[model samples]
Target chain A: MRATTIHAPRDIRLSTVPDPTITAPTDAIVRVLAACICGSDLWPYRGENPIDEGVTIGHEAVGVVEEVGAEVTSFRAGDFVIVPFDHCDNTCPHCLAGVQSACDHLGFTTSGQAELTRVNQAEGSLVKTEGTIDDALLPSLLALSDVMATGWHAAVAAGVRQGGTAVVVGDGAVGLCGVIAAHELGAERIIAMSRHADRQALAREFGATEVVAERDDAGVAAVLELTGGVGADAVLECVGTDQAIRTAFEVARPGSTVGFVGVPHGVELPVRHMFRRNIGLAGGMAPVRRYLPDLLDRVLDGRIDPGRVFDLTLPLDEVAEGYRAMDERRAIKVLLRP
Target chain B: MRATTIHAPRDIRLSTVPDPTITAPTDAIVRVLAACICGSDLWPYRGENPIDEGVTIGHEAVGVVEEVGAEVTSFRAGDFVIVPFDHCDNTCPHCLAGVQSACDHLGFTTSGQAELTRVNQAEGSLVKTEGTIDDALLPSLLALSDVMATGWHAAVAAGVRQGGTAVVVGDGAVGLCGVIAAHELGAERIIAMSRHADRQALAREFGATEVVAERDDAGVAAVLELTGGVGADAVLECVGTDQAIRTAFEVARPGSTVGFVGVPHGVELPVRHMFRRNIGLAGGMAPVRRYLPDLLDRVLDGRIDPGRVFDLTLPLDEVAEGYRAMDERRAIKVLLRP
Candidate 1:
């Protein structure tokens, strides 16, 4: 089997690797059909996060269940499914509370971004589609594995409501998809902050009512102006940079919420400001497993096409090129077929 | 009229001052029956916040409406009322949303500590009691003016549910009252952090199930241990210090909320940790006007005695001593009578 491995900063490569087998009673072997690079992947790839040598790099995919361990009951051989990034035992207290991200027996399983990977807690982690998905819908369905669910979580965490104003603070695939989720949640106005013409256009197509071309304070100012100086009813912080987080605070009205989905990097909240303004903040790693079902339904119903975020696609063998394109900012997200 | 004026740090003086008159069309003059030293007042008295020359300091009071401006309809001469610390026009959009603290026409009306003060937006800011309150009920009704309402807001903002476990960080009057509020809100267990015997007893009397005599990390660990390592379902931060804020974050379970009502002194939120934990933070200055009616009813019916927080009482002429008692930490709160 071949997998994308990261040896050092900016050193991601597709290399031949040993295939994974069912190692636990609850584990299942999945033959990856498609996978993509997530914004979080950039953390280790850009050396912003500490990485172990030769570690597998991706956590987004849709696949077929090739084999299952003795304890796996809900899934069987050849079942088409979407695997959420985090594996969880569905019966945990946190899982029962709908916060699967904090599942008691949670674990991450990514075998070097390989064609075949092992999924732990298979019954709770994988959501099987009704039938074999159409080839044309695979990319979009594959997105439900992480990005789409993550974007949906951002909207849900922000308490986005019908007729509410939602401002998304990033132009990456997740941010763009957040625009879609906010719209689907009935946000009357969706504001996307983007400098790239392509991403900006896609955001508008995805239901962004306006686009602010500036960054940081200027971007926040633009959002406030659009909101008639009251700021956004909900601001989605999809980019975890300090500037983006600060903008999230600056562009939210008093008593409004800022849902942050981006993996925070050097983001410190000015607590005094947040407290005085009565701004609510809630977001972490998206509990993708919690949102995958509804998002998959939206994709299957043709109500959304989140795969449009994948401006570039390539064979699994060309995973290095895909990484390069995303690393150099040439692609918002890359889709790889095995 | 005699008023307590803080000309500088530790320089509080009780002296004759001009009587307050209607300053706005919506203003009403009140002859204060009681005014108390608040925990927030200690911030300026201790030189943490700069004191303006000749500034009138007290914000919490229950008084008799002595005069009303032409536009003041809800309040008139001889009406006994609880005046919220913040003067808000309850008709604004924000006020209608129950965030009167952030009212569009918000104003503050305290002259250092005064016997006679003018309340702006009197029609909305003053909650008149159903009838003249007996002397025994005066203190409890006055508690509704600030501390009790603040505690109630903390519980409400944190979304404390029936049978939920709550952790309150702070042992001030507001924090003690938060214990009562959480109990009234149906919280099954309330953990109050307090080392002082007086406060701990008060907290226990107010329904705190357990008292933790620790601060910061150790306090959080204790709370987590008490909850079987899952942390509290709701955390109320009644102290605005950095340590209190951090403890609130650490002791809240994923998907739970932290309601903070402390007048923030110096605090910073670890965005990365908060993001990863999915903890929700919501709070600000209490919208006392919003809760006064119900809280006052609770007081009038003898369901709660929030005024027990005032362990010491003094005549208005001894206003300086009242400040000294609170500043020396000999009293949780002090009541000054005119």
Candidate 2:
């Protein structure tokens, strides 16, 4: 099997790796149909996050089940499935509570951007697609595994409701998907905060009613100005940067919750400010598995076109260029065909 | 008129002051029937909070409307009312959203422990009781002004639901009221964390099914054990100390919200832990006015006896003793009568 391996900063290559096999009773093997480079993957590729040399990368994909262990009941060989970023037993207390990311038997999907990957807790983690797979639906289905579900989590956590206003911070793939989620949730007003023209255009296409190109205090001022100085009813902090977190809280109305999904880095929560303003903070690493089934339905129904986020596509062997394109901001997201 | 004046730390005295008169059309003057010394009142008495000499101190009371400004329509002379700590227009964006504490025209009650106090936003801040007020209900009515309402805010913010588990951190008057709130909100199991035996008894009486006397790690461990290591479905943080905040988050189940009402002092939010665990932090200064009508009805119906928290009573002239009792923790709360 061939997999994308990371050796050092900006060093990504498609290399031959041992084929995956079901190692546990609950495990299953998946042959990747499509995967993509995530903004987070750029962390190590850009020398920002430390790397372990020669490790297979990627945690998002849609694929067909190749083989299943004895205990796997939900999926069978040749069954189309969306592989969520995290694998959970689904019956654990946390999973039952819809927080699958914190499941007791939590495990991350392994070797996702490869010809074959091992999936643990297959019965509880795999969401089988109905009927035969459609080539056009692969990107949207793959999105349900992580980005789209994550974006949906932010909207849910933020308490976005019908006729309410939603403020989305960050124009990344997840943030763009958040615009879709907020719209699907019936937000009457969706404000996308971005400085880039192309991303802003995509945000508008995803149902952003307004866009603020400013950052920092100016950004908060702009959002407030747009919302009649009352702030947004629901705020999605899709970027983990300190400024993004601060602005998310600042632009939230009193009693509103900021649903944050970004992996935080060097961010100090403004506890006093949050308290004084009666603002709330919710969300974390998204429980993607919890949202997969519903999101898959939305995708199949053609209600949302989240696949539009993939501005570039590449063959699996050209994975290095995909990383370069995303890192250099040449592509919003790069879909890889295996 | 006579008012409780604070000259410095440990200096509370009944001093003559100019009688309160309506200075604004939105103001109402009330003759104090009952006023209670709060845990927050102790902050300045213990010198934890800086104080200016000779300022009237006290923010919770139940009184009879002595006079009302021309524009005050909801409140009139001879009406008995619960004077919440903060006065709000109740028509602002924040107030309309049930966050009266952050109302656009927010104001704090003044000279509440005095013979006569002035309340701003009177029409919106005062909740009139049905018929003539009974002496017995005075204490409970006063509790709605702050402590009881605050406790209810915590429960409400924590999203306490039917048959769910609720953990309350802090066994003060507010926390005891939180136990009542959790019970009223239909939580099947209520856990009150307290080290004081008297408070524990009050907690149990107020509907705490379990009591954990541990602090710090032991406290978190005990709560985790109580919930089969799943943590509580809802957590109320009634104490503003760092440890109390930490324990509140530690005992919250994944995806559960911690409703915090304590006036935080030197507390650093655990953003990383909160994000990783998918725990949410909500609530702040209690919008007592928003909960006033509902809580007041509960008090009148005898469905809740939040006033039971006031274990000691004192005459208006003995305001210093009331403060002293509360400062030394000799009383759960001290109620003062004029």
Candidate 3:
């Protein structure tokens, strides 16, 4: 099986890896139909996230079950499914509360960008559709595996409600998906903070009622300008850096919340600041598996088109160029067909 | 009028100060019946929290209204009321959201321990009961002005649900009050984390079903041991120090919340830690004014007595001794009768 491997910073290579087999009683083998290069993957690509070295990478994919262990009764071979980022035993107390990312026996299988990947906890982790999916909609379905579900988590975690205004920080794939999520959640006003023309256009297409192309204090001023100087009712902190977190904090109205999903890096929030304003910050790794089912329904119903996040698509062998394009800001998100 | 003033760290003196008079359209002047020393006062008394020398020192009180400004409609002469810590307009968005501490026109009137104190935003900051008769209940009613309410905020912020388990991280007046609040919120089990025997006994009186004397790591371990290693459903962080905050975070179950109401000092929660566990942290300076209406009902009903927190009492002139007793740990809280 040919899979993308990260050996060093910016040293991604397409190499032959051993084919996956069901090793656990609850395991199932998935043949990747569509997989994505996530912004989080860039964390290591940029030498920021330390790795054990030469590991198969990627966590989001739409795949078909090629084989199932004897104990996996819920799924059979040839079942179309969405593979959520975390391998959670969906029966844990945390999973019961819709926080599968924190499942007591949680596992992360980082080999999604490959021809065949073995999935653990198959009964709880895999969500399958009854019929075959259209190739045109595969990119969006692939997004439901992680990015879109993550955006939905941001909106849900921020408590974005109907008729409320929301401020989205970051304009990358997840941020764009957040706009869609907020829109679906009935937020009357969705503002996207983006500096790029192309991303701004995509943000608008995905239901951003307003767009602020500013950064820092000026950017916060712009948010206040739109929110009657009180800030938004809910703020989606899609970028995990300190500056982005600060902006999220500043732009959230007093007594409102900031839902952050981006993997944090060097993020330190001054407790005093959040305390004085009665602000709430809730976000970590998104409970992607928990939200995948509902978000899939929304996508399949044609109510939202989160697949638009993939601006570039290529064959599996061109995966290196996909990384280069995203690193250089040439693509919002790249979809790979296996 | 007579008042307590802090001229330096550990230097508290009873001195003559100008009697307060109605100065704003929303103002009311009250002759204090009861004023309690707060744990937060020790911060400035110890010179840890910077303050201007000679400043009047007190923010929690219960008193009789002596006068009202021309525009003051809700309060008038002879009305008995509880004065919350923050002088809030109560008309801003945050106040409307029940967080008066974050009111747009927030003001703190630091003269509650005086014979007469002027209160701005009187209509919003004062909560009055119909008829006052028992002197025995006065101290308990005064507790509602701050400490007790702070504990209630911790319980409410942690979302203590009916039939849930709660762990209180502090056993001070606030922590003890949190036990009562959690009980009132219908928690099936309440754990009080305390080392002192007197506080533990008081915690039981206030509804703590269990007590843990361990601190730091051992305290957290004790909580897990009590909860079958799943952690409590709601953890109340009544202490502001980093160590106490850490215990609150550690004892909270995954997908549960930690409600903190202590004025934060040198506290920093690593985002990475909170993110991975799906733990939530909420609570700040308790919006005492917001909880007053309901808490007052509970107090008046004879269901709970939070005033037992004041183990010592002195006349206005002995206010200096009141601070001394609290500083020396001889008093859990002191009430000054001015």
Tell me each candidate's TM-score.
Answer: 0.96, 0.97, 0.98
Ranking of predictions according to TM-score: 3, 2, 1
For each candidate, what is chain B's TM-score? Answer: 0.98, 0.98, 0.98
Clashing pairs in 2: none
| Better structure of 1 and 3 per TM-score | 3
- Model 3 Cα lDDT, one tens digit per residue, B26-145: 888988999978988999998889878898999888899999988789888999989888878888888988889988878776898888888888888888888764899998999998
Q: What is the lDDT of residue B322 in candidate 3?
A: 89
TM-score of chain A of each: 0.98, 0.98, 0.98
For each predicted model, how many residue pairs clash, with residues at least 3 apart or on different chains?
Answer: 6, 0, 0
Q: Is candidate 2 or candidate 3 better by DockQ?
A: 2
For residues B243-277, could you state the per-residue lDDT of candidate 2 as single tens digits? 89999999999999999999998898888888889
Off by over 4 Å in 3: none
The Cα error of candidate 3 at residue B178, in Å, is 1.1
Tens digit of per-residue lDDT, candidate 2, span A108-172:
87688889888888998999977898799988998888899989999999999999999999999
Clash pairs, model 1 backbone: A56-A112, B55-B112, B56-B111, B56-B112, B57-B112, B57-B113
lDDT of 1 by residue, A1-338 (tens): 88889999888888888888878899999999999888788888889999999888888888899999999999999999888888888888788777888888887758626798888889888899876679999889888888888888899989899999999999999999899999999999999999999999999999999999998778877888888877888989898888888889899887888898888888777677787678888878888788888888888899999989989998988888888899889999999987
* iRMSD of all candidate structures: 1.2, 0.6, 1.1
Most DockQ-accurate candidate: 2
Best by lDDT: 2
Local distance difference test, per candidate? 0.87, 0.93, 0.89
